[model samples]
Target: MTNETMMQYFEWYLPDDGKHWQHLAEDAEHLKAIGITKVWLPPAFKGTSSNDVGYGVYDLFDLGEFEQNGTVRTKYGTKADYLRAIASLKEKDIVPISDIVLNHKANADAKERFAVVKVKPDNRSETISEPYEIEAWTQFNFPGRQDKYSDFKWHWYHFTGVDYDALHDETGIYMILGDNKGWADSENIDQELGNYDYLMYDDIDFRHPEVQEHLKYWADWFLKTSGVGGFRLDAVKHIDKVFMKDFIRYVRENLKEDLYVFGEYWKDSNSDIVQYLEATDLQFDLIDVMLHMNFFEAGEKGSDFDLSTILEDSLMKSHPDFTVTFVDNHDSQRGQALESTVAEWFKPLAYGLILLRQEGTPCIFFGDYYGISGEFAQTGFQDILDKLLYIRKYHVYGPQEDYFDHPDCIGWTCLGDEKHPDGLAVVMTNGEASSKRLNMGELNRNKVFVDYLNNCPQEVVLDEAGWGEFPVQAASISAWVNKETHLSS
Candidate 1:
């Protein structure tokens, strides 16, 4: 089987012209040709406005179909356009995964008086003020939809917290006081900022039976309506773990059995992610954030960073099957809240480590592939990234051998398989030009190899023992492939 690759189909700075779905429909074939087997599309629902990047989710049922939040189309396009884009991807055998944000709701339609206590900004578990009456924007009536799909309306009682108190003209973490409303169990969530339950806007209280039923019904409705093959869950760490787990299981069993569900549990500690996995019973995959942090650190430290420890304490090393490795994403891109942009100088090396190795499933960032627009506009690595994708699709396979002995340089090789002959070699360096004699196996004896990346303009001839010395330039990566196989292909 060919190596599977996933691409984030949208960037953080995409134009708000509502043509993204149209562009995606047109670029389906191009994405398929570039060896992308899966695509994680941005949120398809209406945000606070047409320009909102979908994270500020206003209406769950509004997929650019209703005239809510001052627009009929989202940052992407209309609901029909979104469905068409999914169909186009399905036609090309690429699975479309919709980004699902269920942790909170934003842009409420009305303000309702509710009793709430203010919590400390640093520690959410500690209340800073007594419970008092406050008019908070916690009512989501969806005036435009008018209960078209579901008659359920969200009120202050359905949520656990709100960020802004409209009555008092104050802004803070106000924990909603109700009969049975509070943050999720601390044991099930990451212990960040005392309790990480409240993320933004009005935090959804999954403990409420009504809210739970509503979300489950919404999930079913969305799957049947959108025809997406999978879901990319957002803010899993801040959500109720029990509900999240049962929700995924319910969606898979009731909707589609093969529905792929991955979560964005953005934490750099492997132990924290392992705890989440354990809490959820390992039912889904998580984005390998520690590996991305390692890449960022390596790029920041240059030669001083130990390349040998790149994979240590990473989900890619601990739980490879549950890992979705990525170098950068919309959240980590420049100017974002979680901005930890990997140094561009080490991008080639970082890409090689994720793409060429036999470890976690790699995800190509849209910003890195198509370039970022708007305020922080930057050029992309399209030329080199395309070559790496081609190599990953056609040449990356078989038993792997690592040569991570040096701190400044590292290399690895995939012994060729029957289906993919003349296996490839990858070498990367941060300090200076270096070489590593990696074993290509006796099966690959006397096979001549050349740098498919074209970074090193030289070829290496394997000896009778199937050993070849691979060279890489300073602060760059070289992917060596069989010269004959590369030329023929």
Candidate 2:
């Protein structure tokens, strides 16, 4: 919790003209001034093509350094520009987080014929078609890279599965069981579609010792080459939990830096999240999708929503230390698959909870802070977020008190402490205007409190017993801090 906030600095619809890294470098100081402590950048390695979003990981060793995959630069920028952006952010006391996609590999150097069988997508155990020989894209020699980093030449035996077969011009999940080896069932992959480990491209098998060694080597190379402070791991649920745990440990202990690591496990069930955390032994932080869904539902339901249940079934409530909460992400912003964007009116309230509360690290989406263009039109909430982050940096602290007894309006108080005298009081409503009596400590008896949100201009003064009347407008949020703080003075 060294810093108060993290920003997801890119949207899905952003054009891939290869200038985002330079833009990030230019906005380094501006981001710091706006109270952003860390930024989660998109994947920066060379993808299947020049215009690819860097997720179709072809060569982990080539960070836009060598000419490969039909280009010398990724969709973000060249290797030099990416490194400079990271340096600029470090200079401003901001950490740059890189997205690590290690579940599969694409854009193979060549195709190889292998014996395979087709299985029912719903029940992978039941074979839908008999065994046949098909040419799969399962070779990656990296001739362009020329063994400058590592000489790990990949062939059909390196991968356990591939989605496309070039020989028959057919697309299906074919298990690459060579020399009596099968997909890693011990990884305990998703049971929904049977074997969820094979997501896309040539799925890497963690069971293979060579595969694990190659990934570990790449991890070290990526961390050293990029000089990033942390990683946002992609598709953790689809990979082996044991391997992820080892990789995370290797990153922290091997680098000898106090780095942070977060994973994207997009499940709406709190129980599912809890299960995943247990499997990984809490090695990485998770983006609480269940909590985000709660916010979205609350916003959509409006007055009819139960404000008391806003924090219910949320990882922030049960596991605060490893919960990385977010209001919306690239998938939910516009036309993606999980497009359940929270209503605009409730963004302030949603942000106030994560930023002001005593639990979870909050992430502000790029679309919300800077506004998305071309279809998803928004003026952005930069001004509101600026004020909230200022409060978060200085005034929001100490033990918390919750009054989630109301269905439409609820509030919480953070008792002022010696470190930060006269802490904070927060109130928000999903329905009608309401009031509450929160007892600030007896030491705060004569202190006056003012709403920094400004919409609720009425100032409140605590009585001799330390209780004050707090008012909140309908469908809005009001955050009150001691008048003695910097803003009040």
Task: Work out how many backbone clashes candidate 2 has.
Answer: 0
**TM-score per candidate:** 0.99, 0.95
Clash number by candidate, in order = 0, 0
Off by over 4 Å in 2: 1-3, 486-489
Q: Taking the tens digit of each residue's C-alpha lDDT, what string does model 2 give over 237-341?
A: 888777788878877887635778899988778898888888888888899888899999988989999989998889899899999999998878868778989
lDDT (tens digit, per residue) of candidate 1 on 179-210:
88778888876689999999999999998999
List per-prediction Cα lDDT, in the order shown.
Answer: 0.90, 0.84
Q: Give RMSD to native, each candidate.
A: 0.9, 1.9
Candidate that scores best on TM-score: 1
Question: Least accurate stretch of 10 residues (summed lDDT) in model 2?
Answer: 180-189
